[model samples]
Target: MDSKNYIDSGILELYVYGALSEKESMEVSQALQQHPEIRAEVEAIERSLTQLSTAAAPYQPDQVYQQIKTKLNFKDQEVAMIPITRKRTNWPAYIGWAASVALLIGLFIQFDKNKELRQEVVQSQIEKNLLEGKIQVAEEDLTKTKTILSVLRNKDVIEVPLQAQQVAPEAYAAVYWDKESQTAYIDVAGLPTPPPGKVYQVWSLKLDPLTPTSLGTLDSFNEEATKVFALNNANESEAFGITLEPEGGSESPTMEQLYTLGVVNS
Candidate 1:
């Protein structure tokens, strides 16, 4: 039966009043043993009935407990009786639980710290890779610049100093003309700024007839940090000159705006 069905059977009330037969009492005891809810209800009804019977008494028993104790021979007992067998320590269980909780908290904190350390390691690796890439690019640029420097230092190369001319007397430049390589490296370190919308153009000049050949314009003059440029010249050149011209440079040299002139050494 369900708990409510068992409760409504009135068997618990009969058991509480001690009015049930032996077989019925045994059945009720079995049901009470199986169902703790039914057992609790039976105990509640017994207690209520016991209280009612005690209240129904005309005179309360003062010596009744003493008489029952004498019948059981428990009067004037000297020896103390221990009720339970297990030796229990009050605080150890709480201390063990607290210690376990503390240990777990410590482990979790360590785990979080380890995770953070791992992230730091990964971030550090990325930073290292970025730095290495920058270093490699710098090394490559350094290698190229060093090769150019070595070629300019060769003994066979002729160095020419291009002096500032009348149009721009403050501007001066130098050229390292490698006749064999047909290459000229111009260092315009002392050159002044070109006028707005104009650029400095290089010219290869033959002195006998004063014939001039256009080499190329120094297009990136303002933006160059070193103020140096390289040009190819396979000419039987006698002199080098720089002139200021419009953006694309003139087909011929603009002698009026000439900035510098230098003669190649024999």
Candidate 2:
């Protein structure tokens, strides 16, 4: 572009405002270098803006250049005008700042410690609840065991010993009968574990006629720790016998599978 037209386009104003693109700025700089009149005009614009900015400042310094010279020891050295930042040396002011910093650090540490303590308390409460649940289950088990023991030790109950039969000569059991209540507790603690997929069934026998009546099947024979089972015996049982059967007890006793037998006295 021609010089007069380029200067009139208002791009030189942008260059003075520092808003020109890098290429445009370089072009303007070259133009200023090539033309003394253009360079002088740019310098005049810069000086005018600088004066306007200085006049817009809130207040002029009171003591002016002399006071600035005295602070920098500039009379002998001809030092460049530069601001001197003041330093603080008051003991109380330094102590107050240090104390404030220490307090802030202490407060931050306390906050972290409190957060950790709250988390631990929550964890402790969860563990305590779990332990309490376990304790409740254990107490329930104890109550059930106690109830069974009380029934077995009743005064009116009749005790019957069962000796091992030919099939299982080492196995033994005992039955406590409450005739009036029609309940009998079979104690199979001495009996051996039944084979897998097998169970022991109790038979109420009428010895006079040699007839057998089915009582309930004794399941969980191996899993039961105390090996005690309860059954309702309403029939007049003259003899009690235990026989190993399939998963469920047979309608009639499997005589070959008999494990233990006991006869009640007349």
Candidate 3:
């Protein structure tokens, strides 16, 4: 039943008066637990019943002392004597309530501890996932590195070493050409980092009549982790050359800014 309906039904008064069956009383106890309004109503009824019982019951046990003193021949002192009664401290009631309060406090402390432990467990799981993701990325990078290394170290690949040129004497680079795949992998690890507003552009030189075909530009030179770049090369390249060109690269090799050059040995 709803709180309002249950309260108006007068079952709470019966429950408090011990007039209800055990099952009915249990039902009321459960309702009181679920609804604060029902609990409040039941408490008010219990208080009223207690007050009625107290008022009806003879509260003066002092009359017994008066009769005892009269029988002991204290009749002359009766007229001048004042009645005094000291209420005994209910130790059993105090201990029972104190124990109940202690138990409630212990439960509250345990609940807080459990909540903290659960949060710690959740945080640990988040950290574990983060670590696992990093490990996965590291493994992927390792696999990529191994694959690139194997391609560069292939016996059939033609290795061309480009020497430093006039524009940048300290710069150097190497090209690993796969004739079958018509591709070239340029290892620019030895090349000096490019200046701002400029990038390193590679070329496939025919050497005869000085024909230089644009291969591609190393756009992310500084950002590349391995400093190796891949380019499609279908030309019958007789030589390879690298030049420092404007950011987007030049239509042809910038002869003045030529950083490295190497002729392929047929």
Instruction: List, in order, the clash count of every candidate structure.
Output: 0, 0, 0
TM value for model 1: 0.51
Models 1 onward score TM values of: 0.51, 0.54, 0.53
> Candidate 2's residue-wise lDDT over 56-143, tens digit each?
4322233333444464345634433322332222333444567689989999999999999999999999999999998997886787
Ranked by lDDT, top first: 3, 1, 2
Best by lDDT: 3
Report the C-alpha lDDT of model 3 over 1-266, residue by residue, as the tens digit.
Answer: 67787787666755664545667778899998999999999889767645644445433334533544454446656534633223433333555567689989999999999999999999999999999999998897787688678887799999999999988888889999999999999999988888799999999998769999999999988877888888999999999999999999999988999999998988
Q: What is residue 127's positional error in candidate 2, in angstroms?
A: 7.2
**Number of the top-ranking candidate, with TM-score as the measure:** 2
Candidates 2 and 3, the one with greater TM-score: 2
Clashing pairs in 1: none
> Of the candidates numbered 1 and 3, which has the greater TM-score value?
3
The lDDT of model 3 is 0.81
Over 4 Å off in model 2, which ranges?
1-20, 25-133
lDDT of 3 at 140: 73
